[model samples]
Target chain A: MTRSPFTNPYVLILPGFLLSAFIILWPLFQLGNISLSEVNRFGQIRGFAGFENYLAVFNDPDFYGALWRTLIWTFGIVIGSIGTALPIAIVLHEDFYGRGLARVIIMLPWAVSLTMTAIVWRWALSGESGMLNSALMGLGLIDTNIQWLAQSSTAFPMQILIGILVTVPFTVTIFLGGLSSIPDDLYEAARLEGANPFQLFARITLPLIRPFLNIAIVLNTIYVFNSFPIIWATTQGGPANSTDILVTYLYKLGFRFGKLGEASALSIMMFALLLFFTLIYVVLAMRGEKE
Target chain B: MKRTWLLSVAGAALLSLNATAQADTLRVTVAEYSSKTGPYFEEAATAFEAANPETDVQIEVVPWDVLLQKLTTDISGGANADLSIIGTRWLIDFVDQGIAAPFDSYMSDEFNDRFFPTFLSPSVMDDKTYGLPIAASARAMYYNKDLFEQAGISQVPNTWEDLAAAAEKIAALGDDVYGYGMQGKEIETDVYFYYAFWAYGGNLIDADGTSGLDSEAGYQAAKLYKSMIDGGLTQPGVTSNTREDVQNLFKRGKVGMMITAPFLSSQIATEAPELSYGVAAIPEGPSGARGTYGVTDSMIMFENSEVKETAWKFLDMLFEAEWRSKFTGGEGFLPVNKAVAAEPAFADNADLKAFAAVLPDARFAPVIPGWEEIAAATSDALQTIYLGDGEVEATLDGAAEKIDRILGN
Candidate 1:
């Protein structure tokens, strides 16, 4: 059929494409430019120095340490949120009293800023006068107050828990949307076939929510990988930079030390890593559905 | 319709040009020291605008923690204010990058004579004044009097040996009371260690221009703090407490003694009026050496600021004795203006007198390019040692090596 110019795909998408290019691609172009140059602390370009900044990132021991911690932090938070949120979404989906209030309560944390939540958690977890230690002591859980943010051992795990906590509300919202989309008939048909409760969940509910779970996984991975405030507000990736993930370490190198060239390089590297994981995950997810 | 839009755009442009030609907006980025900082500056700006009708002053208040990052991002984007408040230690980097404009031409002889020499000296780099000290403070030991009496401590400890004994006695009078409130976290963690390091006769940089972190003073200082932590004389969680946290404990009367800036006095005044505390010189170490940290946050002009003269006028007004007295008195900062320091509001204050008593021994942060990184490195090393995760000797040596490498650059 002869198409109108208005209906042409390229013509329809041109404005949007240009807007996004101006918004994202321009700063990206600048970042790439800075990455390849010998830049001064104020991000003023001094001269061209190809690959030197990237080489510096590869050589630093702190970069490697942060890279490893970043992997753990991302996986721990993403998986923990999903693992916790799925059951929560399932519970909320079922017919129950006060489900409306329950949903609102679950969604409340999402409304507060992450920085405020983190700051509140910091005070709650303080060593001497923390609410947590007092509660623990009142319950006789331990003889003495624990220094929660003293070092990596307790601090990293507590940070991951807080990260998981903040990520759950968003994850649960996605899950609830997926759960509601599944028709009641699907569960009934399986139930009439004499499937047990766990069997019915495995057979009907799991597959129905697969796509939403996939979306949740990819988005949460991208978000948790770059999250800053939870670690920053609590420990500032410290007790000797022991809790530093790539983002916190990136901040220190870029803002704290004013190493713009290396910071830009690290930013580009982190972007590539997230992009690679997302693409690979989507491919694997689509292939699994096909099979 | 298109013609109408074009005419409107043109009219708006002329309106803006008319506004700019009438008044210049002199923007200043201020670091928020306390809740009172913003209102104080806003009041100052209103007074400034009232007198200098051609200038409309804008004050952007940034918190202390994010001030540098904000300034860096602002500078990189060419969106920085005409003036900013920066830590004097960070002045070298600003000068090296040519981001800070020299105020030499702007400073008249009388203007130069206003500030105390000690406070003014840190901002003088390469013999050109790059900044003016806007707020100054020095560290001193604050002890809880009741706790000292209960522990039956007759005199405040003047030496390390005596201080350790006093700490033991205070710890013995325990009901969750700590003898020493040592800070092992966040900003100034390294400086907290330096009190003893300086007292034990160490330099931040050795005579040969290398880091002195691995020297006898360094080893002895770390050993002393670690021993106290092990001996349960300091706070329970050494590495968990920040300077503010320790200060909070002191205000709560849980900490027997802590070393901090003079601002803690103002904090205690309003928060705990009956805390029964006294400020004294930071205890000396062996060899009769003692030191306290002297910090000055300086007001600087940016190199790219289009409104330099008006900005200088504001600076001159700010440095005047009347304005300086109000600011210094309100913010609890030591007065950098000599005339303000002589005012009874500052001169007659007992807690301030204790802080001022040690001004001769005040060691400002070394003016170097990589000072932040060096401080971070030293702080990280100290935290590691404090946590008992790394051996003291090895950690200090490793940190010293790292600092020397940075210095070498």
Candidate 2:
């Protein structure tokens, strides 16, 4: 009584399914449960609290502000990085001198740890004695130094800028890979048919790389949506909660404030938002694939 | 051969059991000292183990910022240490959660009386002591003598007006030098605000347990800070500077005054010996009263500690006169024990004496649940005010309302 491999596809995927269930589903279920109940500081579940946690989150102005900021942070970084990366990737895709070295240099920010990048950028952008301030002052661009991370008006923009800077390298690599995967014969045929560079790009290049572009946008959106260390290390979502995004606020609620139930509700909200974006992306990708 | 091997295996197991039965190991965790090796905890452990040869003391040092998270994780995972040093404010939370054991049974009244009542109050809830204060610190004004001389100020400022005048004089010296370095960021933001708020006779909570930041003193404190920033007595972009950044500015002789703790004295001694400075009680406010913030850390025993007696013995050893003096002196912290306070090592030091003078006047933040969130709210309000985002009165009022809500009022 030997069993064939096709006897059960579920069994074939059993290990991966279990791993995902343990790593992802269990904590998520626990989070959902905790979100719906009242929890004390010691992680004890105190009876069910209905939709109280969710109501508290919805009623809180900070949560609303953070949700808006989280959207701005996510889209700003995702679009900024990919938009910048496409040009750099196109440039890098050319047969130029020192292309390998250039590629590595551009990818260095992605290689370095996010925390290190944040700390370095923090020092560089510091108010009184930062390198950026010093350079700006020396260059006579401004008479006074700007407190980049300290002022609300500047902090969020600076965070987004730093987020894009660190995000661009990886995005560039993805775009470069996508560019490389496009058959050069198509471009050669287009050029022979007297198609200009714009036509070559609009028709052959983009269509061919549509799958990679979808992946780049969707993954970047998710990554930037959940980014924490950069914002936490830089501002801790402050100057007045001006730079706070959803994840940092969730951390403050859960760990700092010990409002685990509310924090869990916020986490579920963030999860749903990201999930919504992911579903839309998946559907669009599938439709494009069918076409 | 199999029987012989089995007998040898059993003999080995018995030998291991005998080894385990010989000595008891008490695990302890302490907040990190300035040094990476945590010499204070190491020395205490060595001395404790020396006294009790039959017991082994295993000590772990964790940084203050991560201590609570680590302890909570350990407690949840059922791997907590026998004893650990925690912030005094956290004592109530730990006791309420049943994570910390009441020390009243292990401690005598005389032993408990050894600590200053102000320092010991936070460790007690409902008249049951749960921890013992090991180290304490209070904020004080530090002035750069060189800058003071350059500004032609002969004495440390005694009143808030005089301090402002001195700041003006210091700023008059020009060349990128500022008079006062305000900490407008992070943890110290609200603390700096409190220093002024208390100086002006403001309180966070009133006798009736209501938000007190809407009082006149609160408005005065905010106005004073705003005036200092707007009058050009403080550096541009003061809102960007943290306590450490401001201290560094003072150390570089670029700033004239800062209100910080005794820790800065040692930092200056090590980092900027060339800079001459003097420590004084913070300037009196318009109310003619001086006040500063104080913070304390306590050593607490866990409820589930298996070696409770051994752990208490080790803690008792740490509180002995000689060991207590050594620990406090080594860490540059104010002593919790009165006898340790009278020791020549602390009394003879100029900086320590200055801080000690203000010890009685120092006030601790209210030890209650949700105080962290309250502090953060206050810090946010202060930051907003400092950055000129909102009116001082409006900001303070908004913060008070928010805090009242947080306090469930």
Candidate 3:
């Protein structure tokens, strides 16, 4: 007897299931196991130590500091990116001069390599001999050159600014796609009802782009939370751990300090935090859709 | 078509078999220096291959920042090289993990006595020698003579007080030049701090494995550096500058003096030849003790290597007096071999001679399992002190407590 392709869905999905098991589930299981054990410098498992690594991470002050910093870093980038992108996306959606060229120019930051962006920003922000400093001084904006990446206060803000700069282009592209998907009939009807630009935007554009905004904010939060190269290349989370996020701190624990077990524990915490946020967002979006 | 395909397959198999039979290839990895081609290793490899026709040496150059990570991955994945140059501080960990093979069985008394005692100490763990030192460096104060002359400094600073006075004098020149350049960033921040710490008679760990950072010597060292930053003797953004940045500043004739290793000599020659510079021993502290931070890299053989004898033969060829001299001199590193130091090339170079003078008094950081973490913690503490985030003594005490916990005390 001949069988249809969908007769046994499990059989058809076996390859994908096996691939996910091998690539994702297996490593996650290993990470969970490692988080509960004692791992030495040589990557050797020195027997299991139940809850020891977790307790250590919980009590560590650096971990708490990194948690707080990660929140600030994540929120700052997500909010700043969306805030900047929404306006630009609206403008770009309108018919304007050099709109194609403007889109390309706006997306350039997203196209450049992150490491290259970091290095270029570092050079420009250098205190002693930087183009930014030279231009500022030339314009009589400040009496003395400031070390943007060297000071604790400025370092975190500068990194956040760069994060926002790199994130906005992608956010704008997504918003533009979302804007295009909104039918022009709704906008025309609102305009024909004598709706102002702001009123039309508030009633039509805002409600229509909620899904895109949700995705952009959640994804950008995850991306910025896990970002490493920008902080590592710029300040190394330094000038006294002022800018350290969870991932860079995890890196120090695992690679620099050779504490795999502790690093694994920290990794699980990071994953749990991100997953919790993701689940809440998903649930909220689903509920909204149901309403 | 069937005959042609079979003949081609057979030919490829025969050629591969013949290639394998002709040469026993040994894989060697070395840390990358500033030189793009790694001329020292290339020259040594070529000479060793010439001397041992049956053995082929494949050299892999890795940058220092990622060398340990690469080696760790390779060892875990069972793809470790037959022989590799590793930082001496990592020797004990490698030995403990059973990844490195002891060299005692292969060494003769004459051959064993070739290395300087100080340079050889880090490779010996529990009286079992696991590696041989290939390159060594000692930190010293490098001063730009033109900057000093412009500041009207005739004599090099001799004491911490003298150094501070000289720095103030240089800073007074006032063309945006810093008097002292401190490396507050990664790679060797702890080492730079130790230059002052050791000179002040401080130690990282005592006999009982307790941290000594809270001692008066440590406080004094931290305070001295803090005072330098506060007094404007250092660059404005001292916390952000790495050793490389400070080196660039000095090369640009903007900094008066920086404490760095001898490797900077070659860099200065190539990057800033017109800039005149002088090398001198670091200033003595108030305690009347002088110290220089010594770092060494050694060639280690892996326990899993199949071609052990061929690897040993290649090592022997590379360590011959002539080749060793050329390797050290060409790379601008201090020699591990006694005969290499006597070579005219090193002896004639004034900067090399200056660095050589301080080798006898050089001291290495403690070779322990968690020393890297300790160094990082200490660097953070020093940066905090420099930035005036906390009181020096309290911050150092806090760092010492953290270190003690890391030491499992």
Give fnat of each prediction, in order: 0.71, 0.59, 0.53
For each candidate, what's the DockQ?
Answer: 0.78, 0.57, 0.56
| For model 1 chain A, the run of ten residues with the poorest summed lDDT | A186-195
Model 3 ranges with Cα > 4 A deviation: A1-6, B1-25, B37-57
Q: Against the true structure, what is model 2's DockQ?
A: 0.57
Query: Any idea what lDDT model 3 has?
Result: 0.87
Candidate 2 backbone collisions, by pair: none
iRMSD per prediction, in order: 0.9, 1.4, 1.4
Give RMSD to native, each candidate: 1.9, 3.0, 3.2
Q: Pick by TM-score: which candidate is best? A: 1
Model 2: residues with Cα > 4 Å off, grouped in runs? A1-6, B1-25, B37-58, B109-117
Query: Whose lDDT is greatest here?
Result: 1
lDDT tens string, model 3, A214-270?
899888988888999889888888977778899989988887777889988989988
Per-prediction TM-score: 0.97, 0.94, 0.94
Writing each residue's lDDT as its tens digit, candidate 3 over B15-37 gives: 89867775588899999866743
lDDT tens digits, residue span A185-212, model 2: 9999989999999999899878887888
